[model samples]
Structures are given as structure tokens and as C-alpha cells.
Target: MEPCERARLHAYFSKIASQFAPAEPAASFLVTHLLAERPAFVRAVAAMSRLRAVLPKPKSVNAAAQREVEQAIPCDTLSRELFTDPDTALNYLESRAPGESIVLLDVGGYFTPTISELHSRFSGQILGVIEDTENGHRRYADVDKLPCPVVSVARSPLKDPEDFLVGQSVVFSTEAVMRDRGDILHGRPALVIGFGKLGSSIARLLHAKGVQVTVYDIDPVRRTQALSQGFVVARDREATLAGAGLVLCATGSLSLRGEDFPHLRNGAYVATVTSSEDELELDGLPDVYTRTAASEHVTRYQTTGHYFYLANGGNAVNFLHGASVGPFIFLVQAEILAAIRMLTRAGLAPGMHEVSANDRAAIAATWLSYFNR
Candidate 1:
């Protein structure tokens, strides 16, 4: 976007920011910006971090699950699908269309759309990727083999896709923005609910930064492995929630005990994978209800959003933080997969990141339609 366009986008956001404060959810904010075609989103992190929400805590890592991951994860060959079919993958997403022009990216501790299915869905539309792992690249080597137009950006060019994607691209802002809210995370103790792709990524980030991290999950094996990795593991929610600063829920489970929140330090931050928003309640917390992303720090606050509904909202916490580092690999690869048959049909090239507002708007719309249906 040009300087003028960027400025106009900011103005638009300033106007709508107040109207949206009540939503207390990321999607409401993201989807709203998508609709306005205002790419320059006034990030929720910028809004919530101002208060310096004093949300912090610490705990032990879960045992059984950690041990299992330590034993099973480290040496596995991430190259092969192990046992997944590419064609079925595309079909699966086609069945779920969501009617949006999507850029498929992975979320930790959550199920992801398959490669072939994602490729088939966004044929000729995808361009770049934003990944946190080396394996993410190996899986789609064919795209990498393509020339120029298909180049991939390895580092978290938290800078801009303009470094790569130029003109009107349909992009997927995956894990990038998810873990961004530094104000919320500044001095907090953390807990990771699931250690799958999403959970593990965030846990590693927190630990690397020297924050006390505790892991919790249903898989007994994963629990043990995470512990061995040196992370403190908790036995259950009851054990993990005491005085916690931030809780990242990336699991498939829907409801967790309320006592977990009551014990949370007042003004604590709680974020989850975009997919898990409905699983837990953020309204009835012990004191002040703070709704924010793991990446961007905070999004909306239930305590202040009016008439606590226990529904704080959702954002891709993984994307929030992952964006902090980037070439925006995950969905960039997905978009490339989507554009494969169509764009690559003409010739081969490494897909780029920076996407067009039109493409993302379409994807968001389609995603909305699918979810509504």
C-alpha cells in the first residue's frame, strides 16, 4: 500500500476502533478490517498493552505427555506425510469451503487442513509461507523447486512482504501476529494448555525468553516429553491456574473449570488458538477479565467491554506471535499451493508472501460463509 493509502487506512481504523471495543475478540477486529479493506489494522496489541495489564504467573510442566513427545518428536522424519493423502486433503477443505479465499496455515494443538486439499482449494491463489519449522519447507519441496515467482522467505521478516510479495496478493497472516502483545507478555508467568504444533511453538518461545512456562495436555506421553525438555509441567488445570499471568489454550477440548480463572491474577491475559475460542469462557473470571492474544498481548477486555458475556473472542495467538519472526511461511506456502495448478500451470516459480487486500477479503468472506453454514 502507498503512504497515502496507509494513512487513510489508519484514519479508518481510528474511526472504527471505538465501535469495536465491545467485541473483545480478535476476529471481530480482524474481520472488521478485512471488510473495510483497511489493511492497516490498528492491532489489538497496541490498544490493550497501554494499560500494562499486570497478568503473570508460573507452574510445573505436565509429565506423561512431555515424556512421550521427547521420545517420539525429536527424531521423526518431518518430510513424509507418515500416512496422509494429498487428494483427500483438498477434498476435505472443499467440503468445508467457508466461502472465503483462504490462505491455509497451521495452528498449534489444533487440527489443520491437509496439503493437497488446501492446494486444490486455493488453486493459483497462494503465494508465500510463514513457518516456524524446517519440516514445513520439506513437505512442499516441489514448490521450492520452481523458479523466481515462487521464492520463499525463510526468516521472520517481521518487516514486510513488500520485501517479497509486490502488488495485490491474497495473503495469509499466519502465526505472525498471534504472539505479539509484548505489553501483556512483558512480565508474566505463562501456561501452555496443549503442546501440539501451536502449543509447542509458543512454549519454546516463552522459555527461550526466560519466562517460566508450564505445559498441560491430555496426551500423557507428550506431557512427559515436554518436562524432559526442561519445561515445568502441570498435572491438570487445577494445578496450572494458580496465580497464572497468561494462559494459552490451544487444545480441542471445549470447557475447562471456572476455578482456573478465579485463581488467575486480576487483569491477567488469556488467549487461545482461533479455533478454541468457544471451548472456554473468559467472562466469569475471578476479578478483571482481560481478553488478549498471546502474540499481540491484548485484544479486548471483558471487564470493560460491557455486560460480561464470558465470550472474550478469538485470534490466531500462534499467528500473533509467529509474525514476530517471519517470511510468513505457513499460509504463504498454502497460497502457493492454491496458486500451483493455475499460476504454476503457466510456469514454475517460488511463490511470494505479501498478498492483495482483495484476495484476503475474499478468503475472509469465504471463511465466514463456511463457518456460518
Candidate 2:
């Protein structure tokens, strides 16, 4: 939100707006983390079409600030709480503009089911969707048939840099939260439960901090990649969890459940790096365990002789401290804008598609030129 950052973002978005024709009029729905930079991205999307409703992810931090920003834009900020339930979201969307053409811009496919339901009622009225996260992409991937064109920037090469920075932010925020409780990560045992882009980055960064990082991934290929990177790969997940002083779950799925809680080392700190609560089954905490608040961002769950800490109530710890990824995030945001532009064109096929390589290259070139200058 600095003056320089604002000016740079304005210039970048202006450049993108010039590259594509104005979007055909359609109501827009956006689901995203309400971070500081979100207002700029929202503004960029608003420029392309009519923004109907903005749904902030419940797990994302800084809702108050982002809500204030949304006041200036001509859109309704939907209830973050109600947005989670697909049926409720569908009802809200239906009530907003009945029988009108609508487009979706989502972060984690929170509206996947809502869109599916909408398609059943008003098929072609739903123009298309632009999804921005791998987590969201997987949600759409699970569907047997999509009702409209869905463009994903999740796995695009343009997102590579943003993924790297996300990992860095996770660690940075984790350290800050740990420090609040008079703890440090150096020379401690750590277990990272996923070896995907975010997991691998977290593992490497933790290892660089002198933490003995052990990695585990359900995928053999990812495990091999972790091993090749010179970090210990966990073959026995329970054993690794029992030994680590720190545990970070990077998998977007349910990486940890109630049954897995007892395996954690006593007094060990656990955290997640994904926006969804699905990453950890916190509600599944067994009757034996007693829960207590250790601090604003840390929770203590103890059972008899065993206990472990949960950071940020099992949500992404990075968001507890605002989840800043610096200016590099603009690359991915620009790609999302480009994806929205793609959705505006006629005759696009249904189902998920990668952000076009030409669009990716153009965005990357613009990013390089802006930063280099």
C-alpha cells in the first residue's frame, strides 16, 4: 500500500487494460483473500466489467481494511461467513440478479458447487469462470462436467515466482508467531507434510534456517524430488510427526486429522500454508484432548501426557500477519486479469483450460519491463 507500490500497480494494470478490448457487460463475482493488494486487483477487474459481489475468504486476514476499500467500488461485499456454504452462496447469487449473464472470478473454487447449481437452472446465463489457485483448480478438476468455460492460472508458469514468494511469506510469518511465544526455529526438528511447490519451498527455507527439515508427500515423484534436494524424506509419517519440534502442512487437502494429532511431538508447533480450513480437521480433535489459547495466533491442545500447538487455528499462518508477498504477486494478479479478458471472448470451450502461453508471456514481459525500469 506504499505510494511507489500503488503507482507501479496502477501502471501495470493500465498496461493490461490497453492490451485487451473492453469486456462485454456481465455481472462479476470474485472470491479472494482480503489482503492489502486485493483492492488493486479488484479495481482492475472492475474496470473490465460490472463487479456484482466480492466474497472474502473467511480464513484470510484484514477483512476490515479490505471492506473499507470495497466501499469505494460499486459492489456489494458478501458475507464471508455465508459464502462458505454452497447452497447459501447460490441463493445469494440468485437473489442478486436473476436471469442475468454472470461471470465468476474465484480463488479456491468456493463457488464451484454454486456455479454447478446455477448451471442447472440458468445454463448459458453464466458466462465463464476464472480461478486463481491450485486448490481451486483441483476443486474444478473433481467435477465430471463444468457448466461453462473455466480458465485456471493456478499451475501456469507465470505463477512460479508467486509460489516461491508464498513459501517465503509462510516461513516469515511462522517465525514471527513463534517469536511471540519465546521460541525460535534454529537447529530444531521440523516436518513438512507436502513436497509440492509451496511445501518444497517451505522445506528448503526451513532447512536453510538450520532446522532439520523432514519432508513427506503422497506422490512418489514429489518425494524423490525432495530427496534429491538433499532434505530428509519421511517414509513413516507417524514417526516423523512424533519427532519434529515444528510441523507445517503445505498440502491443500486434509493433511492432518484428529487421529494424527497424538503422533505429534509434545509441545511441537503445527501450522498450515493454505487458505482453506480443509487442510486440517481441527474440529475432529478427540474428546481426550483439552484446548486452550496460548496467544492471539497460537492454540494449545493437550491430552494427558501428549500435546502440540496449532497456529492461527489451523488456517494459513501467513495470513495472521497479513501475508505480504511483495510486488512479485502482481505477476499472478495480472495473469488473473488476462484470464478474465479471455473469458470475455465468444465461442470459448467449456471445462478447465490453462492460461494461454501468449498471455503468460505478455504479462511476464510487462512485469520484467516494469521492475527492470
Candidate 3:
């Protein structure tokens, strides 16, 4: 090649490689590349590296973190493999099925990986998948790409036909377990209020277990949508209170209080999977059963003609029940284990959802593994 042409080729190749730097580093290099004519100014570019650290990381980090913990970053890594892959988890869920075909309801931002696991392990036995957000829908099973039954939808549509989807669908759960607020109803007619994505999943999970379900959502649109999906919509607060099994209050918001508790059924086993105080007002109500977060989030009150129980006093419902951690890896590992047991009938040897006493140590171990520390 000619000398001038060779120099131009070298410059072009150099420019292409510089394009791959991190955000701030890329910007400074771009500036330097342009200022190469002024040699002195180009050499001063090292000063800009500090500015890159100050700028915020992309919001994609937030989404990834949400995918990790199910909520925000308030919790620690309970299981690392959940964020990594679905083998261990798929193995666990498969163990639970006992040769029976299994169904799973995944409600969150990251569900594609789980569906893939199900498709691989269960093969023909795998059912469908649903999620809340539009991104989740796109990221979920690609019906065209995969050779299994996966929904190419963000929300389960009311169009076509509303059919009853069944099987043992483990939900995108939280960290909370109902230790207090006794009178647990293992099975009966249950009133589950709030029909957003999470509530719908919980209602479906119960329905699969053969429980009579009455659904309520403040939004008429959700009620209409849920009804078309075969849910028996509860109209009156009084009628909602007349039920006989359990009452679960779940709105997307985790900051719920006693004000959000649904009117109960006669002997209802109430516990919220959303936030604990979604039942604050019903606390101490005769048949009202709930998780233990009420201790941190509830306040008692007596009203005219009847006693009004606030749903949440202070504590969060998910904190008391199973936390909404199933979507991401930290919680993902536990969910996969459940799925493996459910689908493959495999068992976890031990330390499935174990938590360490020291927070720093746990975080360090997770960080080291996540970043190869």
C-alpha cells in the first residue's frame, strides 16, 4: 500500500477500537480524537477520568438489581445461582412435581431464563408464562425462537378466550413468612383484593390448589380484565367481608397501610404477599389471619357500629411473608429449586435458602462471585 493510504488505514482502525471505552472514558477519548490537531490539548485528557465516576450509572443497573432482589437492593444475596442460571433451580422444581405435570406463574421483570429452564427440563409438560411489564413480555420466552408453549405477551390478554390455567405455579415471592397473626386457614374460600399482576398471580396460585377465589381491585379496568380471565369479581366491600376462607391484600405498592385491608370473610385466614400492612386495619379481627410484619406496621382502632382494623401498622407484608425475590438471582436460586422439585422431582441436599448471620460477609461473598473478586 502507498504511505498516505497506509496511515489513513491505521487511523481508521485506531478510531474503531477507541469506540469501545466506558461512557466517560469514551467521551474523553472522542474529544481527544477530535483535538488531535492541537497536540498539547489532546495530551491533557487524563484529567477527565475522575468525572466519569461521578456520573450516575445507567438506569439499566436499577432494572438488573430489581431482577436480582425482586424489589430494590434492600436485601442481601440469599442464593447466588439464581442470578446465574436455572439448572439448580429447575432441578428443585422438578423434584416437587412427583411425576405430575407442573405449572409456574412468574410475575416480574426477568422471567425468560426461568421459562427456558422449564422448557428444557419439563419439555412437553411446561405450561405458559406471564409477567407485569412490557419489557418482561419481550424478554420472556420467544415463541418463534423456542419450540415450546411460551406466551409472547406482556399481559395475559382478555381477548380470544378466557381459560382457566392450572397447575402448581409458584409465584414471584418475597422474603416474608407469616410467623404471627395466627388462625392460619390452609384451605377455604379466600378473598384476594387488588388484581394487578402480583395479585393475579397469587390468586391463580391459590386457584390451582382448588380454593374458591373472589378477586377485588380498586380499578374497574383491572376488575373487568380479571373477570374476563375467569376471576369472580367481588363488588361490595360487605360481600367481600362475607367470605369464608382467607383474605390477601396486594397492590403493586409496598407502602400499603391499614387503610388498604379488604373487608374480611367469616373466619378468613388473612396474610398479604405484597406488603404486610396491606392488612393493618384487619389486625385483631376475629378470623383475620396475616403474616408477622403487622407488628412493625399496624395500628388498632374501633369505629362507630363496628371495629375498623388498619391493614399495615408499619412493617412490610413481603418482609413477613416470602419476599418478592424470585425474579432475580439472589431470589432466583430459591425459585429455581422450587421449580426443579415441582417439575423434575429433584431434591436440594441442604442450604437451599440459607442466610448468613453477618451481612458484610454475605455481601462480600456475593460481590466476589458476581465480579470474580
RMSD, one per candidate, in order: 18.8, 2.1, 22.2
Q: Give candidate 1 misplaced runs (Cα > 4 Å).
A: 1-187, 252-260, 275-279, 282-312, 317-373
Local accuracy by lDDT, each model: 0.39, 0.81, 0.37
Provide the lowest-lDDT 10-residue window in model 2. 74-83
- Arranged by TM-score with the best first, the candidates are 2, 1, 3
Clashing pairs in 2: none
Compute the lDDT of residue 352 as modeled in candidate 3: 13
lDDT of 3 by residue, 1-373 (tens): 3576445434432332242222322111101011112121112222212111111111112333334332211222222244236775555444444343443333332335555555566533543332323333444433345423332222323210111111111121111222244423355676766776557877777776577778888789999988998889987766666554556665533322444334443323344532232224435344443333333433333333333223333333333232223112222222222222222222322111122224224333442343241
lDDT of 2 at 153: 87
Residue lDDT tens for model 1, 77-174: 22113215556544433433333333223212111224434444544333223222222332344443422232222222321332133101101122
- TM-score top scorer: 2
User: Against the correct fold, how does model 1 do in TM-score?
Assistant: 0.37
Residue 197's lDDT in candidate 3: 59
